[model samples]
Target: MQNPAIPPLASEFSDLPATASHGPLRIEYRWVNETAATAPIAVFLHEGLGSIAMWRDWPQTLCERLGMRGLVYSRPGYGLSTPREHDVKWPVDFMTAQARDILPALLDALDIGMQERTRMWVIGHSDGGSIALLYAAQHPDELAGAVAIAPHVFVEDISVESIAQTKQLYETTDLRNKLGRYHADVDSAFYGWNDIWLNPAFRTWSIVGELDTIQQPLLAVQGHDDNYGTMAQIDTIGERVPHAQLVKLDACGHSPHRDAPDALNEAIATFIKSPSKAPTSTPARSPK
Candidate 1:
């Protein structure tokens, strides 16, 4: 369970206009340490079921510790953003769409200029980690670096099995009501993600072929005991992106930021401070 004692990250909503494939939506976004506007920026992309609130104080805590600004936001159909239609399902390329289009639109809307865009890093978890990778692949010139925690390069049976179990738990337990605390429309958030992952066609979904396109500094982290994914998620990425760094933590599970925040933050901080020299599995520094 997430501790409720941590203060919420301050936020503001941006009323983004309709896109070619979607309608108008409002994005719930927060800036951590706005006073450090000139400092390097790190954007926090939440997990599939996560929201700005669900991220708790990690983004702020990390940025404060690194002396960097943080941009944390909930994507459409999650958190305070617009909800998906009741009968809808996310496309197989949902993560791709988010990376290639939605993110750029929001950055433009925020007037985050080209210079800042080039200086920004992305810290992502799960599906968010995939988005960060896809974005880096398509827009390498705009990113300074990326830290992906438990990111998926390919779909796995374990991931689907866990998601299916979660579906059952949500129906039988208080998971729905619990998740409601973080989302504006819980069903939209839950079903939109669940239906697609459980979709038979999504089983072959993989972006591993495109991993070679990512030229920015990369830090990939996952736990040795991750139930939702395996070491291949990061190892294969490192294989494709030779310069990518990897950190595998012992005695940790899927949510590294929550399960091992100190180590995660330390590794990321060390990487961002001097990415070129970031160690690959170096104990003095670290991911998931």
Candidate 2:
């Protein structure tokens, strides 16, 4: 696909300084709150190809609504952050790398650990949703709650097929150009996510078993028309995690925050502001 001209609004976060590298990559992030207020800290994790700028003002809006602090950043290989130089693909163990290595390194670098002094709330979308799930499952003690939008608990055939189609779009259409506006180097962000999800070894991936380990409160959401994943993704989460809540929005696509911002904001604010106690059992499925 021919690259598109960078959008005028694309450089909104260009001036934000990058944090010193605690690992091989230098992390870039934007903080909405400087004061150590009583409101919980909500960390916003973008989608596979998403960056701080691509998120627009959703994080800030949510933070203001809930009177909470917001932290937004791009993953190592995406957005304005450092990119991997090799042609290596994202391995089947990508989730493990994120859960055990990248996330901790970023948190430590930012001096934001799971210590009780800081109660953290994770809001992750798409691939980020999976990362949040992994983090919450591994360190349930560190998080107050998690909200995963369009999370994939298992590698479904449909997901692989969709990714394959995306590869074709990247090659034959202007998809690359559109992505370039959100990422400094679209290829690094694109292929790092694309190649890994479509890898043959990724077919055997499943985090369903790990869901049982997540003792913290969880809100699993998906759009009825989400092209990237199906209701089964969120369903499996509720089935395995007794305390999990499921919400499906109608007329919504893969990107709920973009397609249905009002509904998404309401759902998140409600979940985040609610009492920390987990429900006795899974809430009844409410599919919009």
Candidate 3:
């Protein structure tokens, strides 16, 4: 449960114009430490099945600790943002569309111009991490750096297995009801992500070939015990981007922020402060 003492942050909405494939959308977002007008912005992107509510107070806590302003928002189909039609399905290039079109449009809607964009940093988890990497690759000069936690550059058998299991849990258990609290349309959020990943055509989907274009400082993190993906995910990132820093946590799983907050926070703070000097791995710590 979220701490009742920490009230929900004020939220604002941005309207994104219709694109070639979809209608207009209203994105739900909030700012952390907005008073820090001069500080660089740290944009927080959630996991595939995450939303602004699912993120809770972590974004605020991290921004305060780092002394940086932060941006947290729900993608079109999650949170209070516009939900997808029940009959519609996300495309194979859905994540790509987010990185290439939706994110930029949100920035524009918020009046964040090119100048502010260049001073920004993207911190993302899971599917969001993959989107961050894609954004970095497509617009190398728009951001200062990027941090990808448990991001998948290429689909693995383990990923498929885990996702398949999650589908079962969603159908047979109370997963839907649990996730419903964070989203206005839980089925949209769940199915959009689950359907695409389980799609046979998506098995070959990989962003490894596009990562060579990213020139900014990059940090890739994964848990030694992550069920959704393996260290090979970040290992491949390091191989592609020589300067990329890789951090593998012990006793952690798919969600580092929830499982190893202290270590994850420390690593992120250190790397964002001194991108070149970040430790390659954090010492093993008990999962929270």
Best by lDDT: 3
Off by over 4 Å in 3: 1-9, 279-288
Worst 10 residues of 1 by lDDT: 1-10
TM-scores for candidates 1 onward, in order = 0.94, 0.86, 0.94
The alpha-carbon deviation from the true structure for residue 5 of candidate 1, after best TM-score superposition, in angstroms, is 16
The residue pairs that clash in candidate 1, if any, are 221-288, 267-286
Per-residue lDDT of candidate 3, residues 1-288 (tens digit): 232432355778898999996799999899988899898899998999998988888888899998989999999888878998888989888888999999999999988889989999999999999999999999998999999999999999999999999999999999988888888788888998899999999999999998899999999989989999998899999889988998888889999988888888988888988988876545546445
lDDT assessment of candidate 1: 0.87
Ranking of all candidate structures by their lDDT, best first: 3, 1, 2
27 Cα displacement, candidate 3 (Å): 0.4
Model 1 residue 149 lDDT? Answer: 91
lDDT of 2 by residue, 1-288 (tens): 212443434232222233342235665678875364666788888888888778889888888887888878877777777775556666787776677677676677676755731388888999889989998988877888889999888888888899899999998999988888877678988888888888788888988888999987789889888888899999899889867877788888899888888887777777766735434323222234
What's model 3's lDDT at 267?
A: 85
| RMSD (Å) per prediction | 3.4, 4.4, 3.1
For candidate 3, the 10 contiguous residues with the lowest summed lDDT are 1-10
Q: Write the per-residue lDDT of candidate 1 for residues 111-157, one digit (tens) a residue.
A: 98889989999889999999999989999999998999999999999
lDDT of each: 0.87, 0.77, 0.89
